[model samples]
Target: MNGDWLIRGRDGRLSVYQLSGDAVLCRSERGRGGAWTAPRTVGGEQKLHPVLGIGQGIDGYAHLVSWRPMTNGESGLVHSAHFRPHLGALDWNPVGHPRGQGRRTGAPAVAVDAQGRAHVFVPGEDGTVSLLAQKEKGGWEPWRELKGSSVQDCLAAATGESGRVELYATVPDGILHWRQQEPGAQPVLQEALQTQVRPGTLYALATSADSTTVFYTDVSGDLCAWRPGDEPAVVVASAGPGPVSAVRCDIDGHDCTLLAQRSASGRVAFAAYPTELESAGAWWTESGPQLSLDATVSLTTDDNGRVVAATSSPSTGQLLLTARKDEPGLALEAWRQV
Candidate 1:
């Protein structure tokens, strides 16, 4: 999802937003671990998972988008919802609709610019990528093709200076492409990057004026990175062999990164980068637990520097946890079920 947030509750608890079944849920850190705010039906229809975003503007509005299935159980449309944490309720009753029915191959990818304008991306029924945007001043633009075919079902976004958003996705051939989008400016597609970003791999992005970096796992689950125009990707963590989860968040007013990859033994390969992330292996200096989480997990951090993860499994139930900062950070607080 596009928005990265500093969601602090009244008691200073941290919250992670997620979608369960067809509803929007907010799980917050409690005494030792956390508790779930009641599930709220933000979107009337959805299947699989929805992307989440919390605006950076003064409104602090939060957003969600999901693939709405048709009567035949196929994804035919995209639906979106809005919420405000200050009000503790959904502020908008209307769902934002994409311009048309879609094959819904990819989940909605969203990002909020410095100005609080939200940008959304999704794969269309015709094998092209669709782009939608909401203005910071208000109102949504009609959906339009951003161009591409054989695109995979994953998308990522990063906002840089000058209101530009860099959107990236992997095509079937294991190559990645990115484009720079600015409001009312001519968009230019960049040359394809040979990131070797495998199909079905979860990826995260980090951007700055100087460079933009993509982080993901290879087919064998070794962590990797691609820095456009600078150099070829380097393997950050050798094949841990499982699902990858990552997020850029803030702790104590500074940027922090959280990364997790499940190992072959069902234990999670997790690390926290307190400074700008460079060599990830060094953060593994402390020892901790081996664990597993659903591949579609999103990570966040509390003001306390504790990592909070929202994850799910069809058989084991959905989970939310705060990584123990003291005990080598491998030890998890008791997880609350979603």
Candidate 2:
């Protein structure tokens, strides 16, 4: 899955969503410190792409979006929302083609505003980014185009603590950005940034109420972090060729950022640093046995406020999860396959 595979609900329970055939399967923790339930299919079957985009709102609803093959040889985006923890998700709702009949060329990215409205961003074949957003009261507005060119598929979206949404995408030259001037307003295009990054590796994390930090692998296989208005990107650490997953948590009474990625050797590598303080440095530590290269890692804080990391077993397809130990620093428990 290209998007989020692990999600923490408002009730402190965690749910794991994975792609199985054309359907989306989910397994949730029964309760805090409880065993995870068996994998059960949630969203109905469809001709879905390998990508899955998940965004959660302050109301604890998880919005899901993916592309399905259309009859006209184009791709259409479908959506579903998960509200209750144990209950099943809503049926897949068609968001239609971003350009009416035009095809979606890349994976869709989702971000939920502070009001719990979902905004879906899709890239069209013409290199333009289209947005289909949920209205405040209910319903959805017509698809609108956000002007851009040569926009690559590495689209990232994050809603700031102020309830405004920000978007970033990779262009041939550098990076394109869009931000909402205020909550519930449309995102206006900002100045394009000059930086070379690998496509499909963009990930955004809202660091504060008004600021967001974006992380991605550079062309040289080094992980970097850049916030708006930052002149040069800060190199975080050397990483593999895949996307990275990160979450902010308190470590040893200090606010820190934890990152995980699949290394070139196929093992899960982890690193932690003081949040927004990359100059302090970080070191990559391998955790868990090596799996398939396609296997992705996800991170979230558990009910007890401990950092948890999860991935799927390539051979058994079982959900493998581990949590940070109660000790000091970034120690973790052994991998538990459920």
Candidate 3:
């Protein structure tokens, strides 16, 4: 799993795309860190919100969904990349057959159910949630609308026991929305079981067959979690007043979600939460480096050990992508610019 971390961003200085990931191209290895090559611009002046999903093919095709900024007046897109046989050059092809153009909210959420099919949920025009699913044979289905205007900022997903993709989002009215998807069948949509909570962004992690752990920004701008059958508990006080991201990871034998957030002063921080019920919060490592908005942190394609965090510098407006490999029984290292 040793390879260079791919940094995909629009460099305002050069006004081009700096794409690097394939081993044969510029990557060293997964565990090591290094400098990136001088990227030759290939696109226009725009921002990209991309999520990577690994496939089940022999080559394990990596699927990417790039959600364009709403101000750019562009629609969401889909792309696929894979290494050729014998470690040949990388192949990044556009396989997007989109449905329509609309405003996109936060970064798109991706989840592969138990059936090995990838489901991409994107928030678009009027806070509508659209889905672009991969077919069984070898292609992508046209973009299909899922739900109407909601918050358009929060979308979290995980797969259930039957491999059904479950999505959670919060609307403007302080309602937490939940839905479960099965192919060819209508999604069962409903409001989450109410606790003493209000409007906020959410990140849901499937911990066990009967439980799901949620970390989110509460009404008072603090980071909190709602465990199974338990009241809402504080994870990080004064956490938000900004955006938050989380990814479920195992520490020792317990399930945990690593939550990251940008503070009001621009400093970023993270904390881990146990999957099962607990009254106490784990020790958080918040004295970390600074980060900007519209940043992203996600588990690498196929739920691999790699964790990638990409952010933009507020002052310089530079996009930075960094990564750390998460091995079981170990912790992630400090963030480094790729």
Candidate 4:
């Protein structure tokens, strides 16, 4: 759908919201979400894959990935959705299934390159990670399994300037590994020893505009940074929540922004970590305006770092999208809208 949607408790009660030319309308089950205006139906009776994406492409179109549900009644499979704004209205269509190679596919990460092609990564059931590339001719190249250790948590990154694509994942060995695919170099596995990022903790990994520096959250609840040429990782900020919900590195220079889900308070907050003094181990910092979220949140940052989209429980609060405008080394200007 052209609008936003939220899914609750898995009773198959999916809520679809449509931003009409006028106002935002929501549609869901009569008993589930109460009687509301019948918004346009987006997905059919099929269950949503548990993830969604909406963003502009290099060709000015919109690329989306509504992850598909698992076949074994678990969690696997991802459905690709594309929206092409040709004349007046948006034409929405499905692209491909974001699956690896084996009998398992879940936790799909998607990114669009400068060529408008989609690059997706889905960790397999065997702990191996795979990559899928979609060409402009509407065909998918053979699934390519990356040469890395078994990764449990995996995410995708794409550089707008270099068209460089990378996959970041946490291996079972508690090591953070990444695979960078570029024009000349083969897919190589590089470890980040500086961050001390271990397993069992949520780590948000991002890269800078130059595609050399790596940013992520460490187990100590601090924003840590590392460069491809650096020997050790350095702490950028210690005030970040120990349980970060979402993190985006490489925002507005080499800064990293994180959306932390405070479990004790169940509130979502934002913080920024900018490393200016590379050798002196100094980094700029900023705090968000604060979002007192009543429900649990699942967070993700957009490519531009201007907005952070989060899904919350209905009984707690309405779904919201926080637009945060960063002022370099100053506090962030944040506004919440449903």
lDDT of 1: 0.53
> How many angstroms is residue 334 displaced in model 4 relative to the true structure, after the best TM-score fit?
7.3
lDDT of 4 by residue, 219-320 (tens): 665555555555545544444344344445455566554444434334454444443334444443323234444343444433343444354443433554
Residue runs of model 4 more than 4 Å from their true location after superposition: 1-45, 52-56, 59-62, 66-76, 82-104, 174-186, 191-209, 212-214, 236-264, 273-317, 321-337
lDDT ranking, high to low: 2, 1, 3, 4
**lDDT by residue (tens digit), candidate 2, 186-277:** 79998888878988888888887668888888787778888887754555655688889999999999989899988888889999988888
Superposition TM-score, candidate 3 onto the true structure: 0.63
lDDT of 1 at 113: 61
lDDT of 1 by residue, 1-338 (tens): 33343354434455555545554555444432445454444444334344443333223445555555455444543434344442354333333345454344556676656566666777654556777777667777677777567777667666554556666677755545555655544235676665455655545455456455666666554566666665544446543544356655554455656566555555445565643446544333222233444433455555565666654442343553445545543466654455
Q: Per the 3 Å backbone cut-off, how many clashing residue pairs does candidate 4 have? A: 3
Compose the digit string of candidate 3's lDDT tens values, residues 29-53.
2322334444322223334444333
Q: What is each predicted model's overall lDDT from 0 to 1? A: 0.53, 0.83, 0.48, 0.45
After superposition, candidate 1 runs with Cα above 4 Å error: 1-13, 29-38, 43-59, 71-83, 86-99, 161-163, 181-187, 207-209, 238-243, 247-256, 272-296, 304-306, 324-338
Instruction: Give the number of colliding residue pairs in candidate 3.
Output: 6
Over 4 Å off, model 3: 1-61, 67-76, 81-107, 147-151, 181-186, 193-200, 227-232, 249-254, 264-266, 291-337
Alpha-carbon error at 95 in model 2, in Å?
1.4
Give me the candidate number with maximum lDDT. Answer: 2
Number of the top-ranking candidate, with TM-score as the measure: 2
lDDT of 3 at 4: 11
Worst 10 residues of 1 by lDDT: 281-290
Candidate ranking (TM-score, best to worst): 2, 1, 3, 4
